[model samples]
Target: MRIFDVAEITRNIKEMCIEANYSLTEDMVSVIREAAKNEESPLGRRILNQLDENMKIAGEDQVPICQDTGMAVIFMDIGQEVHWEGGFLEDAIQEGVRQGYQEGFLRKSVVGDPFGRVNTGDNTPAVIHYQIVPGDSVRITVAPKGFGSENMSRIFMLKPADGVEGVKNAVISAVKDAGPNACPPVVVGVGIGGTFEKCALLAKRALTRPVDQRSGIASIRELEQELLEKINRTGIGPGGLGGTTTALAVNIETYPTHIAGLPVAVNMCCHVNRHAVRVL
Candidate 1:
């Protein structure tokens, strides 16, 4: 069995939190550059250029790419053979978030209550999801989600009769309705076939996949491509200005479900898709 020290985990998580907010991942940057090349609208190309500039400035200045630094959403794959030493794993993760945000100068956005909404100083308490997997390494992914795009997310349970076309239509409609609200040129993550809650989970999980990786399932892969084409065809462009690059990509993830239901969920991310991952 391998033992991982809590202090090392905390330190790595803190560094990841700060780095993720401050810099755009190279893969994401490459995808956006490619999208900008194919974008036909003059304004759309201009917007993409500005986004590139923004990312560059953020990195060079060591500042967050977006004003809303976002709530820290962490996903952990814990190896069964690895034992955590020194502290509770969750507390260590939260402490990492608190120190990262405080020292990085990232904005604090989490609230104590869903309704009363008291600011939770330090952004303590990250939203963490854990899964057990084989091996001795722990893999951590941190995705910081800003409110603009997250607020426009949606989930629906449709009859199985709705089928693939139904799922496609629902996603298209969701993006159409989201319109300017989701901050255009977004990444769309779709989860299908699971229970209502599982579908939502899948949708978020889809976001963890690399932007360029194609879905392994042929049908779902086709759907992802179609959705990407259709969403960009919406002309939502960057920051909602009219253009052909409304969405950079569409990702779909699926799982088996009951015979009677087709649950679908969509999670959106703005141009600044802030996420980082580490394996230890």
Candidate 2:
């Protein structure tokens, strides 16, 4: 078994936090460029251009692309054969977030209480999800979700009879209701066929997929394509200025669910779609 230092994990997470906020991934940049080409509205194309510019500036300056640097969401896949040689894994991850935000000058967005809404100055204590697999390496994905889009997320419990059409309609409605608020030219992640909470988790999981990657399931992929086309047709455009580029992509992740119930969740993300992954 290979033993990995916790300090290394901490440092990597810190770097990921900064890099993800500052740099727009290549796949995402390509999606924005392609969206600009296909955009029918002049304003939409302009918005896409501005987004591209924003990304370039952020990279060149080594700063966050958006003011709302977002809550630190970390996903970890730890190899069972690998042993952590340092302190608590979760604590190390949180420390990474704290140091990264401080060192990178990224905004601190996390709060201490839901109702009280006390600010956590350092953005410590990230929302961490962990899984164990068979290898000797650990893979971590950091996704910083801006509040604008995240606030508009939704979930619904559909009867099994609602079927595929129901799921599609729910997603469309969520996007429509979100309107310009969730930030147009967005990526829509749909989680289906799981328990209520699991559906939400899966929806967030869908957001981690590379922008150009297609779902493995043919039916789900077709659904994703259909949703993408329909959302863009809404003319929400970039920054909600009314154009043909309302959404850049739609991704769906699914799992088996109860026979009597069908749960669906939609997680919305802005064009920034900031995420980074590292393996050690």
Overlapping backbone residue pairs in candidate 2 total: 1
lDDT of 1 at 192: 93
Model 2, span 193-224: residue lDDT tens = 87989999999999999979999999888989
What is candidate 1's lDDT per residue for 10-90, written digit by digit as tens?
898899999899988887899888877888888888888888888899989988999899999999999999998899989
Candidate achieving the largest lDDT: 2
Provide the TM-score for each candidate, comma-separated: 0.98, 0.98
Total clashes in model 1, counting residue pairs 3 or more apart in sequence or in different chains: 0
In model 2, the runs with Cα more than 4 Å from the true position are none
